[model samples]
Target: MPQKQIYALPNIVSPANPVIFNPDICNGCNTCVEVCQIDVFIPNPEKGKPPVILHPDECWYGGCCVNHCPLPGAISFNWPVQQRAYWKDKATGKVLRDSQ
Candidate 1:
């Protein structure tokens, strides 16, 4: 019988939350916490305080929290570099990076 080797992916750590909250702009409504499907945000101890990101890695990047926010520019999400979309033109057959 031969032994099998198992390997883990290299150089990957738990990803940081792409979502950011502007404290000044946020009204502490907790809408983001309620909208997040992945349980990413948790309520702050103080009443009427903005929620905090409880599990950054659990976020699915669905944009629900950002869209539901009542205050404009309050919630911002920076998509991870690795998740950037690559678009290919069907007619030209050229590939373009989304961030470009």
Candidate 2:
């Protein structure tokens, strides 16, 4: 038996790219908080939101938040095509995906 590191490369450049936590859909579950290996998210005391990426560069561009998010479109990230940035959810964040 051996311990396997699923996320061996904490800093690996994932195609998932940088993603942001949307305040609207975020239920404050903190699932993303638990998953992130780089301590990317911090609980926002003032807003009572799930958490904030106080240090984004620490983010490995892994869309762990987006993939595990119970709410749709809560986390925004770049996909393979379009070269354009977009949020997976309906609500908008810092980026936008132009309708093609």
The CA lDDT of each predicted structure is 0.82, 0.66
lDDT of 1 by residue, 1-100 (tens): 7977968867544576567788788878888888888889898877776787778878889899999899988888877789888999999999988673
Predicted model with the maximum TM-score:
1
Among residues 3 or more apart in sequence or in different chains, the pairs in candidate 1 whose N, CA or C atoms overlap within 3 Å are: none
Q: What's the TM for model 1?
A: 0.66
- Candidate 2: pairs in clash: 73-89
Q: Which stretches of candidate 1 lie over 4 Å from their true place?
A: 1-13, 85-100
Q: Taking the tens digit of each residue's C-alpha lDDT, what string does model 2 give over 24-58?
A: 88877777777877877777675647576666656
Position 40, candidate 2: lDDT:
76
TM-score to true structure, per model: 0.66, 0.53
